[model samples]
Target: MAEAGWYPDPAGGEGYRYWDGDRWSAQTQLRPGGTSAAPGAGHDPSTPIVVKGSSDDDEDEPRAGLWSQVKGPVVIIAIVLVTIIALIWALMQLGVLGNRGPGPSNPTEFCPAVTDGNYSVDPHPRDGRVYGGELSYPQLGAPWSAPTVDGRVPFGRDVQTQTITIEQNYRPGQNWVASVLVGELIDGDGFQSPEAGMDMVARCIVGAFYGDSPVQREDVTRRPMVVDGREAFMLEMHLSFDVRGLQAKGETAIIIIVNTSGSKNSIYYASIPDNAQQYLPTARDLVNQLRVGG
Candidate 1:
């Protein structure tokens, strides 16, 4: 029959327990410094000590308090998990974990997507000399004119020699002619060796140049040889296509990556279309006759 107030614990603990008007509650508090009599034993009715849970106790409050106690740790654990995942991704990017061999992380590192502003068709030298006289090739006759140079520098490097290209003039989707590209051998970002660089450049050319057409590549050949007294890597393939607007059915393409002086490299690309299959020998001769200067 005690009024709702804090009283000495009936469980004989050194603390006060909350007693509702009807029953005892599980709530407890530190014992106050004072002599107190049990409730309903002539205790001062006006000086009743109130503790928490003396009023209508909410059952959900205990669960909510328990959640509050553990909420910080749960949030901390979630943050730690996110940090670990991000660190793993960074390591993978740095080639520390889940390494994928020596290749460019991005496909565009060597052969970027061709945009109108990234390339040009300029008049080349008529003397067959190109790249500031560092290279030379046989000049084609009449229909071929002088090979027009298409200068393309990768996205980052500002050097004009990053890629030096020259090709015989021909109407796209109508005729095909042989072309050559000389790329500087970059050391980092997956260009560790001549062979690796050759592979990346070859694949980039196929995707960037013929991606819009339904092209099929076959008869791929890769080898190591010496060109102009320097070590070189060569890649050759036949590409066949049946595009609606294109007149030629296929072409034989070649890529030659040669190491030059000062650790530089030259890339020679040649494509002779099926329509010009008779010129295949001429193309091979051109490859065989490549000359590279310092």
Candidate 2:
């Protein structure tokens, strides 16, 4: 079929070609525009061909097409996208969604003056300390002395506020850790700052002290606590002593962490080697005796 005049389309446009009808011979030949060409003008019969514009030799330019009409819309859409991105960037620069928003609520949210509760509010005798709600939450324990965190509590009432401090007079023998957590718990969404809050400080302390260090199974310790009249938790670790960047030969000492987000939860751990193993249960018993709701 290919050898014959009209050739079969290998690329699948139109179908087979052939001798137009005899005498003239050869399949069919299209001129520059699909018009049949004269018998034989030396044009190759087998070459794949296409027809150009069928209009006359001289034609004026056509008007703009639909694509041209769409350019304005495309440009507008691009501009809108850029504007949105710029707005977001500006907001970020203004410290809107970043680490620099409003600080946490005052540490003394529900203080004694606000409500007639047995709780007493006291500053930690440090500058920047804000409201302090010191009452033995009747739930955990009562007549408790809750002071503002070690220092740097909320001094200003509005906008930015925070309390950050670290206090450690941990009593391992009694399974008691005298900690001064500085932070706040916001009443609303997670917008509240973490200073004056225990979780961040405790985690920081734990990560700093015991992180990546070795802990023997037998040396592991966990204890219970009542924090600000809430159920609490604790942990203590015997770390090999090291100082001045020198490996001081002794067991590493560390306080793991204590968590008590529950009611009547008991913790375990001790500082004194003898009581260390006996720490948690005893402290838990005492915590149980604590009157938290006052």
Candidate 3:
């Protein structure tokens, strides 16, 4: 009470008590085995009871200790977040995730020539306008004209397919005939898993063939194949479709799917006439050469 000065210890301790101008703040010092003096007891005002350490220093120790306790978990959480970010960056660099720009960082590569005298081979990256990602596939030459859209394809609308036509003769005489179609649905949002991308493409092709048509998929088979050292899904089925009101029949049709990401994918497909079994070996060879990206 004496003008906020040190007084006799009120808590019955040997040390002295500090009284602020208004209240008795919990600030005290302990004496060596001496009991606390009663309030207003005798104490020298001229001889200040100096504490060896600063009060601020003493108070800060508890807070620092509390922070140290939480620091371990906080550091662990930060390390985990950094690891996740690094993994995602690595995947993007590998292009397992969708390419961020106009095309893959590296150009796509195609299979080498694996054709017999009767068959021709042409390897080139598909036109970028068709799909933005890198794509390289073999085209059975000459008799096979560049891929064309069958009927009026609405792309993302009614159906999705990249139609390739093969004929013994370019036109007029329809001697040997076959079709190689790469089918997939690519929305504006894109895909994350390569498998999912292939699935959508396969569904688009199946829907196009099965919708309002008498023919149904037959001899369906599923297997794993490799493309550019990456695993791909292969589906072998027999089916037919109406090309311009003319029903074209084929056997041993095949569909190969490679999942590049959730939004991007590649599908290698073909349907050849059963009578043209001689060309089957060549077609299969070409399909084996299919690669998604370099």
Please tell me which predicted candidate would have the highest TM-score against the true structure: 1
Candidate 2 backbone clash number: 40
Candidate with the larger lDDT of 1 and 2 = 1
Q: For residues 6-38, could you state the per-residue lDDT of candidate 1 as single tens digits?
A: 878899987887665666645456863233433
Residue 176 in model 2: lDDT: 25
Query: How accurate locally, in lDDT, is each candidate?
Result: 0.58, 0.32, 0.49
**At residue 99, what lDDT does model 3 achieve?**
28
Residue 180 in model 1: shift from native, Å?
4.2
The number of residue pairs in model 1 that clash at the backbone is 0
**Per-residue lDDT value at 248 in model 1:** 71
Root-mean-square deviation (CA) per prediction: 12.6, 15.1, 17.2
* TM-score, prediction 2: 0.25
Leading candidate by lDDT? 1
- Cα lDDT tens digits, model 3, 1-294, are 356656677778767765645655354655322334423345443345556677877888888999999999999999999999999888866545652211122221211121232122223345431221233455556555555533211122111223334444433564335656443323433235444444344444555433444443443666766667655677666655443334345456776766644454555566676645665676577665665553
